[model samples]
Target: MTFFQILAVVLTATAFFAYLNYRFLRLPMVIGVMVLALATSLIVIGLDGFGLSLADGAARLIAEIDFDDTLLHAMLGPLLFAGALFVNLDDLLAQKWTILLFATVGVALSILLVGLMLFHLAGALGLDIPWTWCLVFGALISPTDPIAVLGILRKLGVSKRLETKFTGESLFNDGVGVVAFLILLEIVAGGDAGAIHVASLFVVEVGGGVALGLVLGLAVYWLLKRVDNYQVEILLSLALITGGYAVSEMLHLSAPIFAVVSGLLIGNVGRRYAMSEHSREHLDTFWELVDETLNALLFVLIGVEVLVLNYPTGALPLGVSAIVVVLLARFVGIGFLVGLLRARRRFSPHSVTILTWGGLRGGISVALALSLPPNPWRDYLVTITYIVVSFSIIAQGLTIGPLIARANADSSNPTSD
Candidate 1:
């Protein structure tokens, strides 16, 4: 099958499975779609492994769908932008110290920690991955995808402050994570870079993107103030995410961070000055719908793209092992930092724990996996990443509800959800 044909199949299958989940299983829609997709991949491949008729021409057809390109290059920019554009600025500003610290310093620390361990771990598993590449994976996976987690959190309905902390941290940290990936990628490729060079790179990527985002956001807000028409303003915001992101990419800026800064600019700074109360309400509803629709498509893409990733049955054990390590590393990083952040006693222990667990990896991991140079080890990396992210969104994302419920039960039992 051709690329478009394969994409069509993936989308249609995702929709069908999503409907089934919506109708019967009644699971988290995104998680359900992924669960169904993984099931389908296993069944089809398993049938083939057994020498069944389903094996004929199926694997080849599935192979044509590039999970990497479809997710990272295509889906991630828009998803991140859509998620960030309507966030609460005051809440975010309150936790700015915490979020900024975690996003920048915390992400770097986690990446180094995970990379050192994975470097040794991969060698133990007899995998020949370079140290730089391990760090590449570390940087990519370290930043939490607030898109998936916030979706799950919204359903769970926790405290307003905790929700803001999760959203704010996730937004900024994703940017830090992406910048870290680029820095490591440069180092891996033998670019003329050192600590000073990396520091300079950080300022340009993060600072420059923030400047551009603020300018664009101010422009959008200024435009919105002139016209009370909600429809036009909404279109302009959409254009901001898509066109703004493309322009940032063309300028060689960080798209993830740019999307984030732009979102914050429009959501926070511009929000007070530009939008009328009605327009704010309108934009929020509009962006919420945009977020909802894109989320479904991204999750469905995750499910359908499983058929597209390459590997053999022999690697399944390795895939499971990689999942274990990523989970272990994430637990270590989040758990350690949660204690540090809450030691100031501003955030509740319960709120902090839920946020830690809510750090579900999603589109960014898929994107970075696809962004890898196509090499012999690329497929293994993809398999490992898919397994880790899937486990995060499905297992951790779904279980976050129970955790939050218990937290609430202990603190504010009488507070109506």
Candidate 2:
């Protein structure tokens, strides 16, 4: 399919599925669309089982979508920027230590735990996967997807403090996760990834991305201050997202981080001092639509992604096991940090439980898995990643609201606990 054809089909399907969701499903928009799309894919698969050719066509269409490139390269920048934009920087700063530990050390811990557990689990399940490949899987899966988290948070009225923790960690950790995935992938692919080299990679990617983001953000803020036109200011923000992301990629920096940093600045400092009231309002409305539209399409893409996945022998069982693996790692990672922070700070009842379950994995993990080099274990990794993500989005995404409500209730009435 040509680019426009692909766009048309995606938009048409998104609109149709969204209508169905609005009409009957009444689930969250992104989750509802995904569920419907997955159901459609399954229906196609069922028809193919009876000697029909629908599966072939469906797979072909899905294959053409290029899930990894379409998401990580094209859609991610704007999505991340939109998410980070409206985040209250003051709240985020208050949880700086928590976000820092969760984004960096917490992610590292989850990667280690998940990798080790999966390596052993794969062995027990008779899958001959190496430890490094398992670590690569961990690297991809450890970070909670910001796109998914932010979308769900919009619907669930969680506390500002907790929401900040969730949003802040998700926004930053994906960049850290991507960097780790690259380092491990290098070692797995026979690159000379020495300790020094690995550290240098992190420094260059993370540091450079942060530096570039601040520079671009400040530049945009300075320019927006001089401009009184809302249209011009909006266009400049768009330029910052598109141009800054591309430049970050060309320089081998972390584009995800670049988007987050730039968005935070533009939404906070720029909104306060740089942009006029009319421009701020227009900018917020524009980015909110961008976030909602892209999120819907992204989930729809994820739903149909099931059609093209190659499930190897024993992959089903292994994938089921991986869901447990990821959850346990998430729990431990968040629990450890929450435990430490409680000594110095206050937390809601079941804060750890909410944080663990709230860590929804979405397109980023699947995109990273799909981007893996074609090797013996790539299919296994991809299948498991899909399974884990599917469960995260559909199961955990649906129930997080109740969990927060319960936590809120308990916090309000201590005697109830």
Candidate 3:
């Protein structure tokens, strides 16, 4: 009944399913646990719909779970930080240009395209939503999920250079995507603010976010150097996720960016100075455990939280339409941008293909959909977003390995990493 007790029960159940999947199923841990949880919850719901014995108790219990808030608020910070921490700092820095363009420019294109397409489609369906609302959806969904992609990428045996580009872009892209979402919100909420002011606001949100992240990262790194206790150091990094996220959010800065900067600083800049040999080993083990544990909880939350959602039956068409528009926008954005990059010497055609397939949507999309204001259509939006996110994370995340293998097969030498 109490909050902490509920969390303990949820986490215990999630871990049990995750272990089962990891040992026997050989499925990607997140997808496996999520699918299992989803099926089980649906079974309970189906029984309730038919008035089966005990359905009431089961359905009520599942309905108490909140998928949206759990992912967006509690799990996302640590998940993104863990993903960013594992990335090779050198490779990320090398393709910094491509990452910036794809993350920043590519996101803008996807948002504008999806918004306009959805706006028109909604009108045809006799739905009258403001363009601002559609743009809000676009911002929320534009970020390619770093946690999901990197999980697959770790299993991807692509060239190191190519892998770095994909991993780096995916990590920063989420940060860029979230910033885009906030910008769209400002436009919706900023009734009296002019265009020039909005542009200025964008700069401050992004620039200020990056600057704040760097400063916080350095400050943490300096504090870390004076300590040699691995347990204590790991706790500091954990604090960076929980405390750092809380502070950044309070200051209206980007929590996702702040976590990434702090993680990367410890992983790269402070790797030598801040950690002793014993501390390094413990730190790595500590975070890997954190990463996997949170990942398990995230997928389980994604699956069971659907039970609590209140999707409207009225806007199913609009919600479905948004899914189609986003899929098309992704194809166009990835195809055009990556193609243009390849043509101008950014990456090879093969490399571009893998990156395109690698744009996996997961927790962030659902979180954004959940973050939406409750309107008549919000229910439809959340349900549809969940559908799309489930497909992307499970279907795409599962198959990306084969794509990477095929793409890398022709090369004489490749990393089996």
TM-scores for the candidates: 0.89, 0.96, 0.90
Model 3 clashing residue pairs (backbone): 311-379
User: Residues 1-417, candidate 2, lDDT per residue (tens digit)?
Assistant: 898998999999999999999999988889999999999999999997789879999899889888899988899999999989989999999899989999999999999999999999999999889999999999999879655555556565556777788889999998899999988998998998789989999989999999999999999999999989989998999999999999999999999999999999999999899877888899899999999999999999999998999989999999999999999999998889888888887876687788898899999999999999989999999999999999999999888877766666767632121
Evaluate model 2: give its lDDT: 0.90
- Quickly count the clashes in candidate 1: 1
Best by TM-score: 2
lDDT of 3 by residue, 262-357 (tens): 778778876667888888888888788888888888788788766776656546666666667877887788778776676554455465456656
Off by over 4 Å in 1: 1-8, 49-66, 269-273, 276-282, 312-315, 350-352, 409-417
Off by over 4 Å in 2: 146-156, 409-417
Q: What is the lDDT of residue 184 in candidate 1?
A: 82
| Tens-digit lDDT track of model 1 for 1-417 | 666787687668867887898998888777887788778767876886677857446556655656556655566666677667667777777777777776777787778877777777778777767887778878877878666566656666655666776777787887788888888888877896778999998888888788778888778878877887778877888888778787877887777777887877777755567767887788888877767666777776676557667774445666677666666676666667666776673656464456557778887777777788866667777777787788888888778877877877788541121
TM-score of 2: 0.96
lDDT assessment of candidate 3: 0.74
| CA RMSD of each candidate after superposition | 3.0, 1.9, 2.7
lDDT of each: 0.73, 0.90, 0.74
